[model samples]
Each structure stands twice: as C-alpha cells, then as structure tokens.
Target: MSDFPSIPRLTSSKYFSSLLLLRNIWKGGDLSDDMQFQRVVNQRTYKGELILFAFDLCSVSDALNAVLMLRHVGFEHFLPLTDGAATCEALHALADVKALPTTPCFWSSSSNNHKGWDTWGAGAGCVSGERRRGYCKAEQLWAIRYHVAARLLASRVNLLHMDTDTVIFNDIYTRLKRKPISDYSLILLPESPVNGGLWYAQHTSLDSGAQWVIAEVARRTWEVISLRIRRRSSPPFDQAMLADALVSAMKGERHVAYMCEHPAVALQPPCANASQSRCAYRHYEWVVATLDARNATPLYRACFWRGDAIVTTDEHVIARKQRLVAVH
Candidate 1:
C-alpha cells in the first residue's frame, strides 16, 4: 500500500459535486454572472488552445512582465486569472495602455478571498517566514488553479497553465504539436524532482483517467487549504502531491505504462543518468510524458540565455525582476 493518504472517490465527495455543478453551469454558457469570462475565453483561445496563469495583487507586476514576455514571443492566446478586483483592474489598465491583445478574468469575492491569506511580500519564497501562513495561501491558490482546470477540461477546452515567474522565448504550442495529442492526457515540465508550475492538459471526458488524476490532486490540495487535516512539519505543496498522485495512478492495473523516448518533447528515460535515482520511472496514461527542462527551463538554471523557449524560474523579489527588465 502507498504511504500517501487514500483519495476519496470523486462521486462521494461534496467538493466534487460542487465541481460537477460548476461544469454543468459552464456548459450552459453561464460561466459567470458578469459574462466577462466567456467573452475573454472566446477572444483569447487560439487554434483550440488557451494559455492560462493566475496572480494576485502582490504578484501583479510579475504577472504583467510574464504577459509582456509571452506576447513578445508571438503568443497571442493567453488569459490571466486573478482573485482580487484590484489586480484585475490593474491588469486591464496596463493591457489597455500597452495595447496588449489579451484580457484578464476576475473571480468574484464569493469564489475566493485574496485578503484573508498573508502575502509572500517582495523577496520571500512560498514557505519563507511563518511557514504555515505562506503554505496556506500557496495551497489555496493551487486548489483554485486545479478547480479552474477541471472546469475547463469538462468543457472540452485544451489549456496550458503556467506560472507568472516563468519567461517564454519561443512558441510552446508548436513544440507540443509535435506530439500526438490522442496519446496523452497531460504533459508535465520537470523541475528538479517535479513541478506543477507548467503543464499542458488536453480536453478529456468528465470520467476519464486524466480527470481522476486532476480530482485526486485537487482533493489533496483542498484538504490542506481547508485544514481538514493538521499540517505536517515538512508540508507537501501541490507539486509534490501531484508527483505522488501520478505515481499512485500509474500503479493501478487499468493504467498503461509507456517509456518516454524523446527527451526534448517528452520526459527523459529513467536510466538517462545513474546518479538521479528519482529520474528512473515509467509514465502512465494519466500523465503521459514530461517536457524536458532544456525546452522548459526551471528556476535553478539559466536556460533562457541559452535559447530555450520557456524558462520556469523567476526572482521572487519585485525589485530584482524590475532591475533585470530594465537592463534587458
């Protein structure tokens, strides 16, 4: 038996039932009371793919820089999701003044409260001082992300969700198109052990294996954010939980396993290196493959300077990012 907590069946959980209601509500074209979300989605979606990222007031600058970088790289279809009205208004203002083609969507206060959780401040990491508070906000944001992704998947919309800290140098959709979409449910980007900061999801049925994986991740994330269980000393963030969930899903008899052959487009083979024992693993249908770090560089490296299309790491401090942008 796996050491991780057992995932409750989706059909039996009230949380999942709410997501189902949301899925149905969205299907009827009533995405939100304001109808702004539907309008944004309709305008931003490109070649059946939508790029998404979420941010709050504290991270608005980084989000704007990210948007600018993405646009600079010839990407036209992207949406920014924010929980705070202030953040949404700021993004709209900046986009309008800058003549940015993309519009942002705001979630009402009924959906989430941006003020309840403490902000990470300028130079702090997610689990900096007051680990519990920071972790709580991080967990909550991730839960919201998964919830949104689930709704999108239910509506049969393909999406690539990325973090604001990440920088793009090329078109990611063209790279993804190299693979056969029918063969995989999700494609992850490797960050040291693993990362949830960047990933791609294909449109899947409500009951498909991929949806089950997403539900399991969301379930665990919600458990942490809701305080249904006590927080552990070494808390597992969404990325770690996602990695574990993928491993567990792979162990199931119904899930088929495949070896990744192309390191650039898919995950490197398990035996690619003898020193990294964790790198040696098989992928299941739930997570078909991983995008190599060379193409999607994580924070620890300087792959952007070396010509990667996407770099996943960014300075947490606003001043640092601003200085770098000024110099560039």
Candidate 2:
C-alpha cells in the first residue's frame, strides 16, 4: 500500500444527498439506483472477493470468433447476458460438451422488466429508442447494457467487466492471488484512453477512488448526457465516460495511482508489477475485412435478441443438472 501515494476516501457529499432525495421523489421506495450507485462508490474501499467481467456481441462473426477462444479458455464463474434462448442453449451446449467451466449466472434485462411500466419506469424506459439509435447508430450498442448487467450481477457476485475482444494472457487468478468470486466486496479495471486500455487492479483503494468519480459523473449526466458523448465522429463513448469518471476520482489525491507506474504521470499499464509480466489483459484490435482476409479469424459467438434464434425458447439443461448434481 505504501508503494502508491495515499488519496482521500469518498464520503457522502451534500450533492450526493440531494441527488438521493431527488431520486426518491422521481421514484419510490429506498431509491435502489442511488443506493446501488453509492454502494459501488462506497464498496470501492473494501477488497473484492471476485473478479467480475462483462462483454456483448461485437458482431455475429466477431462473437463467433470470441466463442472459439472461450473454447480454449474456460470461464465458469463469470456472469454474462444471453437474453435469447437459442443463443443461451448453444452456449450451454458447447460448454457442457467441452466441459468448460460454466457458472449459474445468466442475466437478461428484457425479460426482467415488466411491460406497461412508465416510460421512465424502473426498467421499461432505460434508454430512449431515439437516443439508442442516434448516438452510435453506425456501431452496435453493447457497453452500457453490460454496465447494468455488471451492477445486477454485483447483487451476488463481484464483477470484472471484460470486453469480448479482451483475452487473459496469463492465469489471472493464481497470478493475482484472487479468485473470480465475490469476497473482496468491490473491484474494477482501469482505463485511460489517452494512454491505453489495461484491465488489472493492484489494490482496492484505486478502484475505490476510481468508482467514486464514475458514480458521481453518472448521476450528474444520467439525464443530460446519458453517459454517452458523441460529439466526435469516432471515439469509444463508454470508455470516454469511464475515463471522465477516473479523472474526476483522481482529484486531490496523493497516494492514489492511476494505471501509470508513477503518481501524477500519464495513464499506462503497470507492467512493473509481478502479476502483469507484459500485459495482464490483451484487447484484440477491431478489424474489418481487407484485401487479405486470411489474417482475420473468428473468436466468439453471440446471438442478438432481435434475431429469429432469439425468438425461439429453449430449456436450460445445464442449470437443471447443476441444481440436481453436486460437484464434489
């Protein structure tokens, strides 16, 4: 801990309290959103027991490529979204046969939210249809959905939000001495687009400071910006939001470290750590078909909810089996 400069902890501010009060009026009950958002900010102080991660279909072909990589590497304890039964079935079937480690966590927002709810209701009106289509109409929308999915999974499991394109270069569990389980309370990966994208947490305090800034920004911009800035033609919108949050969290901090090896320096992967030899995580650069398609390869598979396969219903046999048979 002494290796990094110390930083101030996040406490409930007057603005946070006012936001909570307004949230109560906007809805009812204990204001779960505020509470949860605060929980993320507050939980950052505690050590996380799990390494949670999330990703969405980059493309049918891109997704298929990722799934193929999953075949080589197994993820039995991570939570991911698969709203469609056909896709879920295919995923489970492949994992079951391959004996790939699979967890019981499967989340879908579409099925969870009740129909006929208010436009701004709990889950009914999450993202406006117009905003959804216009913001990044060219590219697919998957980042924010995973954000909600991360929070939902946080109810039971500590999350490690991973993009579909990312791959573990080493045995992260043994290297970090932390299982991908919910024990530390809260943890998150670091990101500063200006430097590079690195997914590794050396200490809980960084995550704490990082999350504080992100949650505050989220509350402030939820209504106005929806946390997605599209002023430029091309930029990682979600990453920008997260970067803003990280930048905000680092304010007036002494011990806090932000990806970079030295304090107050630009953000970069902390390869100096023993855990990360070269890079803890590697993100495959997004590529398109070129003159030589031979270099390109499919990595994962994902079925969109709008597709016909998503329309078909299928039973979860693996879940049933996991329930019936105890792995001793």
Candidate 3:
C-alpha cells in the first residue's frame, strides 16, 4: 500500500456550498435543468445515502456477485454500474433489478462523446488476442469511475469503489466503519500497487486539486496504448496512470497531493454498442482468453492472482469462458 499524508476533510458545509457554487458557475442562470447532461455532464449524485459501487463491461457476473456477496459481508446496497456496452447489454440480468442502483454512465459511445472511448477501450492486445499490455476494459472503467466520483458525485459522503472480480472473504465495510469516512481520504488495501480491486474515498477528504490530479490521470488514459512512458516517467500504462493519480501528478507548479490515505483495497473491460444479449460476453471471452492463454494476470491483481491461481472457486468461470470462445 502507498503511504498517505494527513489532510483536512471537506466538512459538509464547505462541500455543499461548493456544489451550489459549482451549479451557479456552470449553469450561469440559463434556467438549465437540475440534471443538466444525460451522460455525466450534470447528473446530480444521490448524496443522501453514502454509496458503494463497482463497474464492469464484460464482468457483469463479477460485478453483480460483488454486490450480492458484499451484502452478506456488510454493504447492503452495493451498486453495479450500468456503464460500458457489456453491462448495458445485460441491463436486467437475473433478479438484480431492485438490488442494483441506477447510474448515469455513458455505457456506450452513443452520447456523441467524441472521446471515441469504444475504440480506445479495446487496445492493441485486446484486438490481437495477445498478452502484450495495452489499455483495456479495466482502465476504461477506472477512468469512468474517477469521472463520476470527482465530477458528478463530488458531494457524496463516501464512495467505496470495489472490483467485480473479487470474492470478499472478510467484512471490509465493518472494518471501514471503525473510522469516519473523513478520517481516511483514499482507501488502499495491502498488495495492490496499481488497481486496488477496491477503493474508498470521501468527497471531503480530498482537496479539489488532488481530485483534479486524478481526473487528469484518467484523461491521460485515453491516449493510444504505447510501451513508452511519458516524459516524467508516468506509470507505464493505464495501471500506472491510476497509481500516479492516487499519488498526485506534477501538473505545472500546482502540484496536487493526496490529503488522506489508508491501506484497504484489492485491485483487480469494454465493448461496442452492439445490442445483442451476448455482445458483452462474446467480447469478454476473447479478451480474457488471451490472458489465460499467456498465463497472465493484470497488473492490478499481479499479487493476488499469483497467490490464488492454484486454489480457487472461480476456476469454473475461466473454463466456461474458454469454451465459449472456442464455440462462437
């Protein structure tokens, strides 16, 4: 886990005031709707209830299971993001309709978002079915999460961002409740150098500058996948981009840094807008089969995957996926 320095919390008064000010600044009294944009421009966060969420494009099973399993542990209302082509394709999977919270994710590239995230999300390795590292679904989801937390949900009490693939063996939220969310800004679990599988951060815990640093990192993730790092030696790829975001970026003289930190998360996909029920599953099979073919684990789960590859309950998943790839 990365070391975190102590910092002041946002305090509800300050944060709410900032929100009102932001509304005014952006709206400019143009009589815009309370929720300005559909796909993340001005969606109001449900700040009343402190939220817990995880995202996936090709990993709905994992995401939904995370929500259900977490309910067994501590988190009662964990949300699964309906972002990316996969989840949107599987919008009403099983009995998760009531349990799953609504989200304002762009999901697909339909919002006229010029980012062309759909193309950028696939990466070179994903297309070629090779083990070479190129930004893929995980980084895309992370970038989207960062945008939601910092931009839309900035006024929320706390956000517990978990990875869908993880099988929670312990009561993380119970342990987290030991301290107020403000006490720890960024929650990091031991063994995760990059993705942390799960992350916890309070809106108030971080200063705007620190938040922007992370936002910038997410933006950088959009660039074409490359083996070379940036001038200042930014993290090698999207994984490293997140690590640096947590640490802080050297953006000119306004160096924003993390205000609070904790050791607490395990780190652990995307698709086009084709609406076939099997769209996401089909894409995910090829994407993950490549990793399995190479016996590779993503950088986010390097330690955990290496440790747990032998004894596993999830072995069946990969087996099923591999078979799926072979057939269609």
> Which structure among the candidates has the greatest TM-score?
1
RMSD of each: 16.5, 20.7, 17.7
Clashes of 3: 13
| lDDT-sorted candidate list, best first | 1, 3, 2
lDDT of 1 by residue, 92-190 (tens): 676667765444444433224432222221111232222333323545556556766666665566777888976643334444444343345566553
Q: Per-model C-alpha lDDT, please? A: 0.45, 0.28, 0.34
C-alpha-based local distance difference test score of model 3: 0.34
What would the TM-scores of all predictions be?
A: 0.56, 0.38, 0.46
Evaluated at residue 218, the lDDT of candidate 3 is 47
Expressed as tens digits, the lDDT of each residue in 9-50 for candidate 3 is 223222121232233222111111234322123322323323
Stretches of candidate 2 above 4 Å error? 1-71, 82-105, 108-146, 149-158, 178-210, 213-221, 225-236, 252-328
Order candidates by TM-score, high to low.
Answer: 1, 3, 2
Pairs in steric clash, model 1: 270-280, 299-313
Better of 1 and 3 by TM-score: 1
When summed lDDT is taken over every stretch of 10 residues in candidate 3, the lowest stretch is 262-271
